[model samples]
Target: MARPSLREKIIESGVRTLHERGYAGAGVREITSDAGVPQGCFTNHFRSKEAFAATILDRYHERTQAIMDGTLRDKGRPPVERLRAYFDAITERLEAAGWRYGCLVGNMSLEVPEQSEVLRTHLVEVCRALTDAFAEAVRAGQDAGEIRGDLDAGDVATFLLAAWEGAMMRMKVDRSPQPIEQFKRVIFASILAPGVKAGSPQ
Candidate 1:
Protein backbone atom coordinates (compact mmCIF):
# COMPACT_ATOMS: atom_id res chain seq x y z
CA MET A 1 0.00 0.00 0.00
CA ALA A 2 1.11 3.54 -0.60
CA ARG A 3 2.39 5.43 2.38
CA PRO A 4 -0.11 7.54 4.29
CA SER A 5 0.28 11.12 3.12
CA LEU A 6 2.05 13.57 5.39
CA ARG A 7 -1.00 15.81 5.48
CA GLU A 8 -3.23 12.98 6.65
CA LYS A 9 -0.77 11.99 9.34
CA ILE A 10 -0.54 15.53 10.60
CA ILE A 11 -4.29 15.96 10.69
CA GLU A 12 -4.79 12.67 12.49
CA SER A 13 -2.22 13.56 15.11
CA GLY A 14 -3.58 17.06 15.41
CA VAL A 15 -7.10 15.87 16.12
CA ARG A 16 -6.00 13.32 18.69
CA THR A 17 -3.95 15.95 20.43
CA LEU A 18 -6.79 18.41 20.48
CA HIS A 19 -9.22 15.80 21.76
CA GLU A 20 -6.90 14.94 24.62
CA ARG A 21 -5.88 18.50 25.36
CA GLY A 22 -7.82 21.56 24.22
CA TYR A 23 -6.42 23.79 21.48
CA ALA A 24 -4.51 26.05 23.84
CA GLY A 25 -2.89 23.09 25.52
CA ALA A 26 -1.92 21.09 22.42
CA GLY A 27 1.19 22.08 20.50
CA VAL A 28 2.76 21.43 17.10
CA ARG A 29 5.65 19.55 18.66
CA GLU A 30 3.29 17.19 20.54
CA ILE A 31 1.20 16.51 17.44
CA THR A 32 4.14 15.97 15.13
CA SER A 33 5.85 13.79 17.67
CA ASP A 34 2.77 11.60 17.91
CA ALA A 35 2.58 11.39 14.12
CA GLY A 36 6.23 10.35 14.00
CA VAL A 37 6.93 13.21 11.61
CA PRO A 38 9.38 16.05 11.95
CA GLN A 39 7.95 19.22 13.54
CA GLY A 40 8.93 21.14 10.41
CA CYS A 41 6.59 18.92 8.35
CA PHE A 42 3.63 20.58 10.06
CA THR A 43 4.75 23.93 8.70
CA ASN A 44 4.90 22.42 5.24
CA HIS A 45 1.23 21.49 5.60
CA PHE A 46 0.06 24.53 7.63
CA ARG A 47 1.22 28.08 8.05
CA SER A 48 0.91 28.18 11.84
CA LYS A 49 -0.84 26.64 14.82
CA GLU A 50 -3.96 28.63 14.01
CA ALA A 51 -3.94 27.26 10.45
CA PHE A 52 -3.54 23.70 11.70
CA ALA A 53 -6.40 24.27 14.12
CA ALA A 54 -8.58 25.28 11.18
CA THR A 55 -7.82 21.97 9.46
CA ILE A 56 -8.86 20.14 12.63
CA LEU A 57 -12.12 22.09 12.61
CA ASP A 58 -12.68 21.07 8.97
CA ARG A 59 -12.16 17.44 9.89
CA TYR A 60 -14.58 17.82 12.79
CA HIS A 61 -17.14 19.39 10.45
CA GLU A 62 -16.91 16.49 8.03
CA ARG A 63 -17.22 13.94 10.80
CA THR A 64 -20.23 15.71 12.33
CA GLN A 65 -21.88 15.90 8.90
CA ALA A 66 -21.48 12.15 8.56
CA ILE A 67 -23.12 11.59 11.93
CA MET A 68 -26.03 13.87 11.07
CA ASP A 69 -26.49 12.28 7.66
CA GLY A 70 -26.50 8.82 9.12
CA THR A 71 -29.09 9.81 11.69
CA LEU A 72 -31.39 12.01 9.60
CA ARG A 73 -31.29 10.02 6.36
CA ASP A 74 -33.31 7.16 7.78
CA LYS A 75 -36.18 7.54 5.36
CA GLY A 76 -38.48 5.23 7.23
CA ARG A 77 -38.37 7.41 10.32
CA PRO A 78 -40.23 10.65 10.86
CA PRO A 79 -38.06 13.76 10.67
CA VAL A 80 -38.70 14.99 14.19
CA GLU A 81 -38.16 11.55 15.64
CA ARG A 82 -34.91 11.15 13.77
CA LEU A 83 -33.64 14.45 15.08
CA ARG A 84 -34.46 13.45 18.64
CA ALA A 85 -32.83 10.07 18.22
CA TYR A 86 -29.66 11.80 17.05
CA PHE A 87 -29.63 13.88 20.21
CA ASP A 88 -30.14 10.75 22.26
CA ALA A 89 -27.03 9.23 20.76
CA ILE A 90 -25.20 12.43 21.62
CA THR A 91 -26.34 12.17 25.23
CA GLU A 92 -25.04 8.65 25.44
CA ARG A 93 -21.71 9.76 24.08
CA LEU A 94 -21.47 12.54 26.65
CA GLU A 95 -22.10 10.17 29.52
CA ALA A 96 -19.80 7.50 28.16
CA ALA A 97 -16.97 10.00 28.04
CA GLY A 98 -17.72 10.79 31.71
CA TRP A 99 -18.77 14.25 30.65
CA ARG A 100 -15.13 15.25 30.74
CA TYR A 101 -14.99 16.46 27.18
CA GLY A 102 -17.90 17.96 25.33
CA CYS A 103 -18.31 18.91 21.69
CA LEU A 104 -14.98 19.83 20.13
CA VAL A 105 -16.58 22.78 18.40
CA GLY A 106 -17.96 24.07 21.68
CA ASN A 107 -14.64 23.61 23.40
CA MET A 108 -12.85 25.56 20.71
CA SER A 109 -15.40 28.32 20.89
CA LEU A 110 -14.72 28.81 24.58
CA GLU A 111 -10.96 28.38 24.31
CA VAL A 112 -9.97 30.21 21.16
CA PRO A 113 -12.72 32.63 20.32
CA GLU A 114 -10.80 35.67 21.43
CA GLN A 115 -7.30 34.40 20.65
CA SER A 116 -7.61 33.57 16.97
CA GLU A 117 -9.88 35.09 14.37
CA VAL A 118 -9.38 32.12 12.04
CA LEU A 119 -10.46 29.62 14.68
CA ARG A 120 -13.46 31.77 15.60
CA THR A 121 -14.54 31.85 11.96
CA HIS A 122 -14.25 28.11 11.64
CA LEU A 123 -16.12 27.59 14.90
CA VAL A 124 -18.90 29.88 13.70
CA GLU A 125 -19.18 27.79 10.53
CA VAL A 126 -19.50 24.63 12.60
CA CYS A 127 -22.39 26.15 14.53
CA ARG A 128 -24.02 27.27 11.26
CA ALA A 129 -23.73 23.83 9.70
CA LEU A 130 -25.31 22.16 12.72
CA THR A 131 -28.13 24.70 12.89
CA ASP A 132 -28.74 24.41 9.15
CA ALA A 133 -29.06 20.66 9.40
CA PHE A 134 -31.53 20.88 12.26
CA ALA A 135 -33.46 23.63 10.50
CA GLU A 136 -33.80 21.48 7.42
CA ALA A 137 -35.11 18.60 9.49
CA VAL A 138 -37.56 20.86 11.27
CA ARG A 139 -38.79 22.20 7.94
CA ALA A 140 -39.38 18.67 6.69
CA GLY A 141 -41.30 17.79 9.83
CA GLN A 142 -43.49 20.85 9.37
CA ASP A 143 -44.33 19.82 5.83
CA ALA A 144 -45.07 16.30 7.04
CA GLY A 145 -47.67 17.81 9.40
CA GLU A 146 -45.86 16.26 12.34
CA ILE A 147 -44.27 19.48 13.57
CA ARG A 148 -46.05 22.73 14.40
CA GLY A 149 -45.69 25.60 11.94
CA ASP A 150 -45.99 28.28 14.61
CA LEU A 151 -42.24 28.43 15.22
CA ASP A 152 -39.45 29.59 12.97
CA ALA A 153 -37.34 26.60 11.95
CA GLY A 154 -34.23 28.68 11.40
CA ASP A 155 -34.38 30.43 14.77
CA VAL A 156 -35.32 27.24 16.58
CA ALA A 157 -32.32 25.52 15.05
CA THR A 158 -30.05 28.28 16.29
CA PHE A 159 -31.58 28.10 19.73
CA LEU A 160 -31.16 24.34 19.93
CA LEU A 161 -27.51 24.57 18.91
CA ALA A 162 -26.78 27.26 21.46
CA ALA A 163 -28.63 25.42 24.19
CA TRP A 164 -26.80 22.19 23.45
CA GLU A 165 -23.41 23.89 23.61
CA GLY A 166 -24.32 25.53 26.90
CA ALA A 167 -25.46 22.21 28.28
CA MET A 168 -22.25 20.52 27.21
CA MET A 169 -20.24 23.24 28.90
CA ARG A 170 -22.09 22.65 32.12
CA MET A 171 -21.61 18.91 31.81
CA LYS A 172 -17.86 19.40 31.48
CA VAL A 173 -17.77 21.59 34.55
CA ASP A 174 -20.02 19.41 36.67
CA ARG A 175 -18.37 16.15 35.59
CA SER A 176 -21.83 14.64 35.47
CA PRO A 177 -24.41 13.75 32.82
CA GLN A 178 -27.21 15.61 34.57
CA PRO A 179 -26.76 18.60 32.31
CA ILE A 180 -27.19 16.39 29.29
CA GLU A 181 -30.37 14.98 30.72
CA GLN A 182 -31.62 18.45 31.52
CA PHE A 183 -30.95 19.46 27.94
CA LYS A 184 -32.91 16.50 26.62
CA ARG A 185 -35.90 17.31 28.79
CA VAL A 186 -35.93 20.95 27.73
CA ILE A 187 -35.38 19.98 24.11
CA PHE A 188 -38.29 17.58 24.06
CA ALA A 189 -40.64 19.60 26.22
CA SER A 190 -40.06 23.05 24.82
CA ILE A 191 -38.01 23.04 21.66
CA LEU A 192 -39.73 20.36 19.57
CA ALA A 193 -43.01 22.24 19.09
CA PRO A 194 -46.29 21.81 20.97
CA GLY A 195 -47.26 18.30 19.89
CA VAL A 196 -44.03 16.78 18.64
CA LYS A 197 -42.34 14.45 21.10
CA ALA A 198 -38.57 14.07 21.06
CA GLY A 199 -37.04 10.71 21.94
CA SER A 200 -34.52 8.09 21.06
CA PRO A 201 -35.38 5.37 18.59
CA GLN A 202 -36.33 2.08 20.22
Candidate 2:
Protein backbone atom coordinates (compact mmCIF):
# COMPACT_ATOMS: atom_id res chain seq x y z
CA MET A 1 0.00 0.00 0.00
CA ALA A 2 1.16 3.51 -0.68
CA ARG A 3 2.11 5.72 2.23
CA PRO A 4 0.18 8.90 2.97
CA SER A 5 1.59 12.13 1.58
CA LEU A 6 3.44 14.54 3.86
CA ARG A 7 0.46 16.89 3.75
CA GLU A 8 -1.91 14.10 4.75
CA LYS A 9 0.43 13.07 7.55
CA ILE A 10 0.60 16.61 8.82
CA ILE A 11 -3.20 16.95 8.78
CA GLU A 12 -3.70 13.55 10.42
CA SER A 13 -1.27 14.45 13.18
CA GLY A 14 -2.65 17.96 13.52
CA VAL A 15 -6.19 16.64 14.04
CA ARG A 16 -5.13 14.35 16.86
CA THR A 17 -2.85 16.95 18.44
CA LEU A 18 -5.34 19.76 18.28
CA HIS A 19 -8.11 17.53 19.60
CA GLU A 20 -6.04 16.22 22.50
CA ARG A 21 -4.43 19.56 23.16
CA GLY A 22 -6.18 22.87 22.72
CA TYR A 23 -5.31 25.24 19.87
CA ALA A 24 -2.81 27.08 22.08
CA GLY A 25 -1.23 23.83 23.28
CA ALA A 26 -0.73 22.26 19.85
CA GLY A 27 2.57 23.64 18.52
CA VAL A 28 4.03 23.22 15.03
CA ARG A 29 6.99 21.31 16.37
CA GLU A 30 4.74 18.87 18.15
CA ILE A 31 2.56 18.39 15.07
CA THR A 32 5.50 17.76 12.77
CA SER A 33 7.09 15.40 15.22
CA ASP A 34 3.83 13.53 15.56
CA ALA A 35 3.63 13.30 11.77
CA GLY A 36 7.24 12.00 11.65
CA VAL A 37 8.18 14.86 9.33
CA PRO A 38 10.69 17.67 9.52
CA GLN A 39 9.52 20.70 11.49
CA GLY A 40 10.23 22.92 8.48
CA CYS A 41 7.69 20.99 6.45
CA PHE A 42 4.93 22.65 8.47
CA THR A 43 5.82 26.17 7.29
CA ASN A 44 6.33 24.84 3.78
CA HIS A 45 2.81 23.48 3.69
CA PHE A 46 0.85 25.90 5.87
CA ARG A 47 1.08 29.68 5.91
CA SER A 48 0.90 29.78 9.70
CA LYS A 49 -0.15 27.76 12.71
CA GLU A 50 -3.53 29.48 12.55
CA ALA A 51 -3.98 28.45 8.94
CA PHE A 52 -2.92 24.90 9.76
CA ALA A 53 -5.42 24.78 12.61
CA ALA A 54 -8.19 25.92 10.31
CA THR A 55 -7.36 23.09 7.93
CA ILE A 56 -7.34 20.57 10.75
CA LEU A 57 -10.70 21.89 11.90
CA ASP A 58 -12.03 21.29 8.42
CA ARG A 59 -10.74 17.73 8.47
CA TYR A 60 -12.39 17.12 11.82
CA HIS A 61 -15.66 18.51 10.54
CA GLU A 62 -15.51 16.21 7.56
CA ARG A 63 -15.37 13.22 9.87
CA THR A 64 -18.30 14.66 11.82
CA GLN A 65 -20.22 15.17 8.61
CA ALA A 66 -19.64 11.55 7.69
CA ILE A 67 -21.23 10.47 10.94
CA MET A 68 -24.12 12.77 10.29
CA ASP A 69 -24.56 11.37 6.82
CA GLY A 70 -24.61 7.84 8.12
CA THR A 71 -27.04 8.32 10.96
CA LEU A 72 -28.65 11.76 11.09
CA ARG A 73 -29.46 11.79 7.40
CA ASP A 74 -30.52 8.16 7.13
CA LYS A 75 -34.04 8.37 5.72
CA GLY A 76 -34.49 4.66 6.34
CA ARG A 77 -34.91 5.31 10.04
CA PRO A 78 -37.49 7.47 11.73
CA PRO A 79 -36.22 10.98 12.28
CA VAL A 80 -36.19 10.75 16.05
CA GLU A 81 -34.45 7.39 15.88
CA ARG A 82 -31.93 8.83 13.49
CA LEU A 83 -31.20 11.58 15.97
CA ARG A 84 -30.77 9.02 18.76
CA ALA A 85 -28.51 6.88 16.60
CA TYR A 86 -26.40 9.90 15.74
CA PHE A 87 -25.68 10.70 19.36
CA ASP A 88 -25.25 7.03 20.17
CA ALA A 89 -22.56 6.79 17.52
CA ILE A 90 -20.81 9.82 18.97
CA THR A 91 -21.04 8.34 22.45
CA GLU A 92 -19.45 5.12 21.27
CA ARG A 93 -16.53 7.04 19.79
CA LEU A 94 -16.04 9.08 22.95
CA GLU A 95 -16.05 5.95 25.06
CA ALA A 96 -13.48 4.34 22.76
CA ALA A 97 -11.18 7.33 23.23
CA GLY A 98 -11.56 7.00 27.00
CA TRP A 99 -13.36 10.34 27.03
CA ARG A 100 -10.09 12.30 27.08
CA TYR A 101 -10.53 14.23 23.85
CA GLY A 102 -13.95 15.84 23.83
CA CYS A 103 -14.28 17.25 20.29
CA LEU A 104 -11.98 19.31 18.06
CA VAL A 105 -14.70 21.78 17.09
CA GLY A 106 -15.90 22.25 20.64
CA ASN A 107 -12.34 22.64 21.90
CA MET A 108 -11.46 25.14 19.18
CA SER A 109 -14.71 27.03 19.71
CA LEU A 110 -13.55 27.87 23.21
CA GLU A 111 -9.89 28.59 22.40
CA VAL A 112 -9.59 29.98 18.88
CA PRO A 113 -12.59 32.21 18.28
CA GLU A 114 -11.12 35.08 20.28
CA GLN A 115 -7.66 34.99 18.69
CA SER A 116 -7.74 33.75 15.09
CA GLU A 117 -10.20 35.22 12.66
CA VAL A 118 -9.38 32.58 10.05
CA LEU A 119 -10.09 29.79 12.50
CA ARG A 120 -13.03 31.62 14.04
CA THR A 121 -14.67 32.11 10.66
CA HIS A 122 -14.20 28.47 9.75
CA LEU A 123 -15.58 27.38 13.08
CA VAL A 124 -18.66 29.47 12.52
CA GLU A 125 -19.24 27.87 9.16
CA VAL A 126 -18.70 24.39 10.58
CA CYS A 127 -21.15 25.12 13.39
CA ARG A 128 -23.73 26.43 10.96
CA ALA A 129 -23.44 23.29 8.87
CA LEU A 130 -23.92 21.09 11.90
CA THR A 131 -26.90 23.10 13.04
CA ASP A 132 -28.43 22.80 9.62
CA ALA A 133 -28.00 19.05 9.60
CA PHE A 134 -29.66 18.82 12.99
CA ALA A 135 -32.39 21.13 11.87
CA GLU A 136 -33.11 18.99 8.84
CA ALA A 137 -33.73 15.94 11.01
CA VAL A 138 -35.73 18.02 13.49
CA ARG A 139 -37.96 19.45 10.80
CA ALA A 140 -38.65 15.99 9.50
CA GLY A 141 -39.61 14.82 12.97
CA GLN A 142 -41.97 17.74 13.41
CA ASP A 143 -43.59 17.05 10.07
CA ALA A 144 -44.15 13.44 11.03
CA GLY A 145 -45.70 14.48 14.32
CA GLU A 146 -42.92 12.68 16.21
CA ILE A 147 -41.50 15.92 17.60
CA ARG A 148 -43.35 18.94 18.92
CA GLY A 149 -44.48 21.26 16.12
CA ASP A 150 -45.08 24.43 18.05
CA LEU A 151 -41.36 25.16 18.45
CA ASP A 152 -39.22 26.21 15.55
CA ALA A 153 -36.99 23.48 14.09
CA GLY A 154 -34.00 25.79 13.73
CA ASP A 155 -34.26 26.90 17.32
CA VAL A 156 -34.38 23.34 18.58
CA ALA A 157 -31.37 22.40 16.48
CA THR A 158 -29.41 25.35 17.83
CA PHE A 159 -30.33 24.40 21.37
CA LEU A 160 -29.32 20.78 20.79
CA LEU A 161 -25.89 21.83 19.46
CA ALA A 162 -25.32 24.32 22.27
CA ALA A 163 -26.44 21.96 25.02
CA TRP A 164 -24.49 19.05 23.59
CA GLU A 165 -21.33 21.13 23.40
CA GLY A 166 -21.81 22.24 26.99
CA ALA A 167 -22.29 18.62 28.05
CA MET A 168 -19.11 17.67 26.23
CA MET A 169 -17.18 20.31 28.16
CA ARG A 170 -18.47 18.93 31.40
CA MET A 171 -17.78 15.36 30.27
CA LYS A 172 -14.14 16.23 29.57
CA VAL A 173 -13.75 17.98 32.92
CA ASP A 174 -15.33 15.13 34.85
CA ARG A 175 -13.84 12.43 32.60
CA SER A 176 -17.17 10.59 32.66
CA PRO A 177 -20.10 9.96 30.37
CA GLN A 178 -22.64 11.06 32.97
CA PRO A 179 -22.96 14.56 31.58
CA ILE A 180 -23.58 13.22 28.07
CA GLU A 181 -26.00 10.65 29.39
CA GLN A 182 -27.89 13.33 31.23
CA PHE A 183 -27.97 15.40 28.09
CA LYS A 184 -29.44 12.56 26.04
CA ARG A 185 -31.95 11.72 28.76
CA VAL A 186 -33.24 15.24 29.14
CA ILE A 187 -33.17 15.89 25.44
CA PHE A 188 -34.94 12.70 24.43
CA ALA A 189 -37.39 12.93 27.31
CA SER A 190 -38.31 16.57 27.09
CA ILE A 191 -36.81 18.68 24.34
CA LEU A 192 -37.22 16.16 21.53
CA ALA A 193 -40.09 14.33 23.08
CA PRO A 194 -43.35 14.01 21.07
CA GLY A 195 -45.33 16.14 23.45
CA VAL A 196 -46.42 19.65 24.43
CA LYS A 197 -42.93 21.09 23.99
CA ALA A 198 -39.92 21.53 26.31
CA GLY A 199 -40.83 24.26 28.79
CA SER A 200 -44.51 23.34 29.13
CA PRO A 201 -45.62 21.86 32.44
CA GLN A 202 -46.27 18.14 32.56
* Per-residue C-alpha lDDT of model 1 across residues 23-104, encoded as one tens digit per residue: 9788888889989999899889898899889989899778878778777656677887878777877787777788898998
In model 1, which regions exceed 4 Å deviation? 193-196, 199-202
TM-score for candidate 1, residues paired by index: 0.89
Q: lDDT of all predictions, in order shown?
A: 0.82, 0.88
| Candidate 2 C-alpha lDDT tens digits along 153-178 | 99999999999999988999999999
Q: How far is candidate 1 from the true structure (C-alpha RMSD, Å)?
A: 2.4
Which residue pairs in model 1 clash with each other? Answer: none
lDDT of candidate 1 at residue 81, scale 0 to 100: 80
Choose the strongest candidate by lDDT: 2
RMSD to native for every prediction?
2.4, 3.4
